[model samples]
Target: MRRKLAAGNWKMNGLVDDLSEIKALTEAHPDPDVDMLICAPATLIAQMAWARGTHALQIGGQTCHAERSGAHTGDISAPMLRDAGASHVLVGHSERRTDHGETDADVAGQAAAAHAAGLVAVICIGETLDQRESGHALTVITDQLRGSLPPGATAANTVIAYEPVWAIGTGKVPTTEQIGEVHGTLRATLRDLMKQAEGVRLLYGGSVKGSNAGEIFAVADVDGALVGGASLKAADFSPIVSALENA
Candidate 1:
C-alpha cells in the first residue's frame, strides 16, 4: 500500500528564524502515522534537516537544476540538494513553469536528476482555468504526466502532485467530484504507463489548508496534500497532518 504523505512547500518563504516552525511541527506530531515533509528554500534546507534531526519530519528542496554541475548561476542541482540533507525535491511546480518557462522535457530531466541523486522527485502537473473551462483539463494533465515523468520513475523515486494553476494561492479548489475524477484518471494513466503504479502516491495541491484538508483527504486516490500558505506554521499545518493521519 502507498503510505500517505503530508508535504509543505514554503516556497521562497521562510528565514533562519522560521526553523522554529519545524521544531514546533515535530513537537506536535512526534510520531505521525503518515509521512511528513517540509520543502523550503534552498537556503533553509540544511538547517531544517539539522533541526529535524531524529524526528520523523523530512526536509526537502523546492527545486533543482537538471544537470548535476554546470554554469547555471543560481540553480541548485539534485546532487547538491542531496548533499544538503534533502531526501526529496519539487519539480515542475506551476510557479517554475510560469515564471521560468520550464517545459515538460525540462521537468523530466530534473526528475531524472533527482533520481540519480537518490532523492524522491515530487513532480507536479496541472491545468489552468482556461484549460478547465475549455474542457481540456484531462488532456492537459495526461500529456503532462506522459511528458514530465522520466522512464526510470517509480514509486520509490517519484511522487505526483496535481495543482491547478488558477487555484494555487487563490483560495480556490476543485469540487470533490472533480478532484476524484482527476486523481482516478491519473491513477489509471500511471497503471497503464508504469509497472509499479499501485505504489505511486498521488497528492492533491492548490489552496489546501487545515479547514478543508479532511474533506479533501476523503476523496478517492488522494493520498495527501502539498500545502502552501497554511503549511508555514505548525498550528495551521498540524491539524491537516492530524486529518491525514486519521484518514
Candidate 2:
C-alpha cells in the first residue's frame, strides 16, 4: 500500500520560541497510520530534531543546496541537513520557483542532492492561475513532473506535491474533478517516468484544511498532503490527520 504522508512546510515561519508549537502539535497528535513531518527553517533544524525525537514526529528541511559541500557561502548542503537530523527536504515549492526563479533543473539537482544524503525529496509542482484559467493546468503540471524529478528518482527517494499557485494561501481549492484530473495525470506520469519506482507518494497542498481534507483526500490518486498554515496548529491539523486515518 502507498504510505500516506502529512508534511508541514513551516516556510520562513517559526523561531526558537515557536518550538513550543511543534511540541504542542506532537503532544496532541497520537499515532496514526499517516506519516507526520515538519519541514522547518534551516536555523531551527537542529533544535527541531530534538523536538521531533522527543515527540516521535519526523523532521525535515525546507530546502537544501544542490552541492554536497564547499564554497557555496549561503547554501545549506543536503549532507549538512542530514547531519542536522533532517530525513526529508522540500524542493520546487512554487514560492522558490517564482521568487527565486528556480528552474525545473534546479529542483532536480536539489532532489539528487537530497537522495545522495539519504533524505526523501518532497518535490513540488503546480500551475499558475493563468495556466488553470487557460485550461492548460494538466499540461503545465505534467511538464513540471517530467522536469522536476531526477533520472534515478525512485518512489522510495521522492514524494510529489501538487500545490496550485492560485490556491495556496489564497483560501481556495481545486474542485474534486479538477484535483482528480491533476493527480491522476501525475500518477501516470510517475509510472512512466520512474518505471521501477514503488509506491511514489502523491500529495495535495493547496489550502488544505481540516474542514476540506477528507473530501480532498477522496480523490483517487492523492496519497497525502503538504500542508502550510493549517499545519502550524494542532487543532486544525489533528483533524486532517484523523480524516486521513478514518478514510
The most accurate candidate by TM-score is 1
Q: Model 1 Cα displacement at 210 (Å)?
A: 1.3
**Tens-digit lDDT track of model 1 for 107-221:** 9999999999999999999999999999999999999999999999999999999999999999999999999999999999999889999899999999998889999999999
Q: List, residue by residue over 80-114, the lDDT tens digit for candidate 2.
A: 99999899999999999999899999999999999
Q: Each candidate: how many clashes?
A: 0, 0
Q: Please give the TM-score that candidate 1 achieves against the real structure.
A: 0.99
Report the error of model 1 at residue 109, Å: 0.2
Write down the RMSD of candidate 2 (Cα, Å).
1.2
In model 1, the runs with Cα more than 4 Å from the true position are: none
Q: Tell me model 1's lDDT, rounded to 2 decimals.
A: 0.95
Model 1 residue 238 lDDT score: 96
